[model samples]
Target: MVTDTDGYIHLVQYLTEHLGIFENSQQQATAEDTVMELFEAQLAAQILLVCGQNPSLTFAQRNLIIREVDSIVYDLEEIFASVSTDKATPEQTMFITEFSGLIKNLFDQEIAKLHLA
Candidate 1:
């Protein structure tokens, strides 16, 4: 299964491929917002997948996971704010590499905890 990190990478790649479509700040802003929304949705679905795998997870635990996802999404938007729509940069690649690992490590830790419980 593709992780949210992978999904996000693909989405960014797709956006970068057609970056010319965003001719103005308004269009770029709208596209960025849409991307963030999609990432948030993907995070939620990932949470659901995790919960499904760990049926014994309590309601509170699930809620905590949801909150974590929300926090991560917020952080990601902030991190991605500097990304240029007109052209790709080294910073964009660095941001993706850094955050994708963080995202994966976070969920891996969470899943490990669930398994250990």
Candidate 2:
């Protein structure tokens, strides 16, 4: 099976190819890869949210996952602001805003799930 990072890298490559996020493929391993890491946390948060709903994990395990996800959320927010949209067209900007909002909502929903669990 592909590792999470690898899977995300491929997804990023696909997006970059079709979406024109960066100038070249060489950006894939450096800048674009970091963005992939940010989204990977979304997956982790979601999995933990589902896992936390089960009785299999002890309180300590659930808490650990929650803490880690909280840290990831912090990093995600930090990097989010570092990405520039200065050169984007109005339509591109709008699409990015919509996508970012969707991701933010998903992460927020995971936070709520953590609380409920």
Show how many residue pairs clash in every candidate, following the order shown. 0, 0
**Model 2: per-residue Cα lDDT over 19-69, one tens digit each:** 554233332333233443435544464555456556565678567555654
Off by over 4 Å in 1: 1-33, 82-105
Model 2 error, position 53 (Å): 6.4
Residues 18-74 of candidate 1 have per-residue lDDT tens digits of 444333434224233344444555566656667787787778877777776776666
Candidate number with greatest TM-score:
1
TM-score of each predicted structure versus truth: 0.49, 0.33
Error of 1 at 45 (Å): 1.7
User: In model 1, what lDDT does residue 38 have?
Assistant: 46
